[model samples]
Target: MRRLRRLLLLLTCLAIAVPPVAVYSDAVAQERVQRRTVLDLLFGGFGFGRRAQQQPNYQQRQQQHRPQTRSEKPKTKKKVPPAIAVPEPVVVAKLPDARKVLVVGDFIASGIGDGLTEAFTEMPGVAIEARTNGSSGLVRQDYYNWQTELPALIDEIKPAVVVLSLGANDRQMMTIGGSKEKFRSEAWSKEYEQRVAALSSFVLEKKVPLMWVGMPAFQTTSMTADMSAFNTIYRGTVEKTGGTFVDIWDGFVDESGKFVVTGSDINGQQVRLRGSDGVSMTKAGKRKMAFYVEKEIRRILGDAMTIGQPQGGEAVSNLVVTTPTDAADIVRTQPISLTDPALDGGTVLLGGSALDKGSGRSPRDKMIQKGEFAAAPEGRVDDFRLDKRPQPIDPQKATN
Candidate 1:
């Protein structure tokens, strides 16, 4: 009886569970078929789930959506620019064993030469000779005829380059063909230009490059004007003769194009450039003058560098090109003595050191006490002495 009851209860429980499970399974299967049918309608029939019907051609749909022109227009191709060719690098030749530079001019050129000398001091295998005649120029050939003497000078100096600066003394009467012509006159200009051309051409004729440096502004406006005129003539002549003309007028002047006595040095320090007389230059001024010419030389030489050999072709063994040491070491390094008497400016008017001599009397004081108006060794004759009557010689002495 107990076993029959247990079997009947178990059959009743299964009947209830089976109906719910079968219903869920049938609903799930229907939902799956509906989803597949929707997918087939939206996408192509060859996608996920089973296919319900064939899909429309995607290519046809795209053709329908896309608008077409009446007739397919011909397309134009875009143009492209051609590539630019690059230039080859320039190869500069190295400098030779020894190179000599000749610097000749008036006082200004003398200063330039000094500056160049200092500039090239450390540059090995390079030598410079400053053959400047301070009181000489293109004018006054009787004083020192550069046009007639330049050839002999070149031969003697044997320089690789010639630098000429003149015309500072040319603003006077020019004697030509047994006649005197005032400065800036047609005859004077012609003769002056001829002399300049002759001098400049001689350098070129010797197979050397010529650099004719131009003059700077002077303290005197009239003098400066004359220098400007001279520079114009120099520029024209130099260019025509195939020589380099270095203009340094701009360097020595201020912003307003006026002359400046004190200006910036090469190192850019403010110092006195023009001297007290306003005609010559200071040490720094001279260096700055050379700076312009040096630039042109380096440009033409194609970056020529310093070497280890001397100008005489001797190898540097014991000498060091440069050194950094104490101030005392520098003082002792040079060959010259600091106390040399020949270099002493003592006894030079207004330049010597005033010795006290323990008498508390300065050299200037002694001069004032003595009422000395003229310098010694070349004293000027006093008016009183000139006023004296000529001494009559004895007749006997005159006969003897």
Candidate 2:
């Protein structure tokens, strides 16, 4: 009994001691796992001198696994718009004895002269002489008296045609017989008409044809109305004195008769015709204004205005025929009439010859004369005789 008790006490002590040792070993292993070095975390290994090697950083690993971006693309250049092309005027040399066209009046006359120059650029027989004072008008006679100056100009230039475009600056009061008269007033109209008659009579006396160009519509309604009245006075006075009055009012206005800044040009193209001031004309406006005057000039001048020809009515021949020295050496032949059949040495016209009666007539002739169509050939698509077999219908056509 004593031996058995000793053995039991020894076994109990072993169990208690063995369990404590195992618990201590487990705790030690857990502590070792928690207390890791920086190199062990990066390399995924323990810090105990085993498997010691340099490892990749977090950023480097992320970069290695990152998706690659598209290759750098080249930048495309911007497209530039083309510059507008302006047509340069063709300059032609004038003849020494070119007929002179004398242009006179205000600054508007200067624009007309420029236009006429371009109009007759191709015609070497015509020359334009522009003599204008921008601020001069019949209303301001003392400022620049056209009555005295025009006669001298007519004698000096010896112009074939005298073109007058004025009244743009004649809206102010006029001094008549040392008395100031308002524009379009009873006294002013009489003196203005007299001045116009005097100017036209000067050109008529010189045997020079006169063309008086009237004013165009303005942006201001009052100014436009004044111009209209002035045009009326100009037309009556000019016609009475046997001078021509050029009405350019329609050219600068719309279909409704209202003033237009942009309108059809001489070439029928849409363009800016007037300046911002509304009174002044643009290059296109000047060209268009001349177009109206050009027609009258051509009509009055007649054959004298023929382009690409000499001043005199002379014919230019390209062929040169040499005549025989002796009359007997020349041979004469009878002229044949265009209606005579002998001209072509044939009686019947082309394809009009009669065919042989034995030969069968064409299907067209048979249908026309006998009202009968030729029979369709055998195995043909259009053959529809009562005894013929029916053709197979097209599958595609049936589906359609």
Best by TM-score: 2
In model 1, the number of clashes is 0
Query: In each prediction, how many residue pairs overlap at the backbone (N, C-alpha, C within less than 3 A)?
Result: 0, 0
TM-score of decoy 1? 0.53
Writing each residue's lDDT as its tens digit, candidate 1 over 1-400 gives: 9999999999999898885544467545533534345656687554443323322444556878998786766777878788788986443332455577889989888988988877767665567788988889877888888877888888887888888899787778978888889989998999889888888888898899999999999999999999999999999998899898999999899999999999998889999999999898998899999998877665444323335433665333323233445666653322333577335443323334544447776667877998655333323454445335556789999899
Best by lDDT: 2
lDDT of each: 0.77, 0.83
C-alpha lDDT (0 to 100) for residue 182 of candidate 2: 83
Candidate 2: lDDT of 80?
A: 82
Q: Given candidate 1, what's the lDDT at residue 112? A: 84
Instruction: List runs of model 1 lying over 4 Å from the truth.
Output: 1-97, 302-304, 309-400
